[model samples]
Target: MKINSTVLLTLILLILMLGAGSLSAFLGFTLGSSALKGVSTPDGRPTTKFASNKATNAQQAGLTLLKEEEILKIVKARIEGKTKAAKSEKLDEDDEETKSSKQKPEEKPQEVVEEKLQPGFPVTAENQGVTLSVQSVRYSGGDLLLKVKMQNKGADSVRFLYSFLDVTDDKGRTLSASTEGLPAELPTNGPAFSGTVSIPTALLDDVNKISLSLTDYPAQKLKLDVSNIPVARVAGLL
Candidate 1:
């Protein structure tokens, strides 16, 4: 009654396979029952204790959980607060600027009033057979113009240079003037020479009266002086 060697080896292998299968099946059942117990309530009912991994993680980390809507509301409130603060700062700056502008005074330009020669002209002065007359006085192109006539009634020829003419204001300040249409030389008993003496209105700003003096050139034997010529400047003209 001796068994074959092949049959003995096959029987041993079959026993080992059955034992491994049983052991694996028991281990799987035990692990499954432990997992079910972990997720079950005390009343033997199934529970969702392992659900919502995010909430579980939050709890573990000791962090407060907030809904999306609540987060958005907080962010919006912060933004609105910042905007209001910026607006308030800008308004304060604008108010300060307005107050500064109101406290300063406005500047005005200096006004230059025009002047005119008054009436009672045609003044006359004579010395040593020489006569100087102011025939008229008027305004031309912002200048005070005086029409003058000169006569040499002497025995010798007299030379005249208007560059030597002296003109002064009431304050004894010298005035600048220009002359035109006058002869350089006057013969004895010659025809009366007429000319114009122009004075700038700018020099007459504070002048109320003027004086004029003239003398012959090279000889200077004759001296003519005209005084008390009036200058009038009224307001309201540009």
Candidate 2:
């Protein structure tokens, strides 16, 4: 009975040892193959929580970069639009100014024209078959200019006596001229001549009539009268 009890005890101990070894091997294989849920790398160096935090941070950074780029593009477009609008406004203003300038009035095209004025009237004088015709008169630059046409129906050219042309107001006021020192300039063209005569503009003030007495020595005298002839203003100049 002692010998049989010892053999049975040894067999029981060997079976327990074999079962413990199989349980240890099964637990090791399960832990290695079925990994933890959030671990990222194959080496399993990062914890599951650490890997999740890293992924969240990378996503946030990428989103922030994209938003900044969108904002920059919007700002750039706005700036470009503003610049173009300013240029367009300036061009419109310039075009309007140019149009206004073009519509403004300008000076007359001709140098002079015939004007019937109230300060003086046409007059004529004849001496030795020579006739002097005064057409029109005007004032400019403190001087009086007269349009005079001269003709000789006779053989010889007639002369205009110096100191014979005189200006007088109705009040007997003798008007003086700043250009009184200038002598009469007669045309040398034979038989017919036409020109303008210049004198002092101040002489026509409140004047009624001007007289020119042409004489042939002590023989005869031809008298001409200019009355109420209008004086014209100068044009084309300031």
Query: TM-score for every candidate vs. truth?
Result: 0.47, 0.35
Residue 120 of model 1, lDDT score: 71
RMSD of each: 21.5, 22.7
- lDDT agreement with native, every candidate: 0.84, 0.61
Task: Tell me how candidate 2 scores on lDDT.
Answer: 0.61
lDDT of 1 by residue, 7-126 (tens): 899899999999999999999999999888848545433354545566788788996689999999999999999999999999999999999999999988978985353357578898
Compute the lDDT of residue 194 as modeled in candidate 1.
Answer: 92
Query: Candidate 1 at 127: error in angstroms?
Result: 0.9
Which candidate achieves the best TM-score against the true structure?
1
Ten residues in a row with the worst lDDT in model 2? Answer: 177-186
TM-score of 1: 0.47
Candidate 2 per-residue lDDT, tens place, 101-208, comes to 999888678878666533334576665556666676666677776676666666543455545555554565655432222224333445456666566756665554
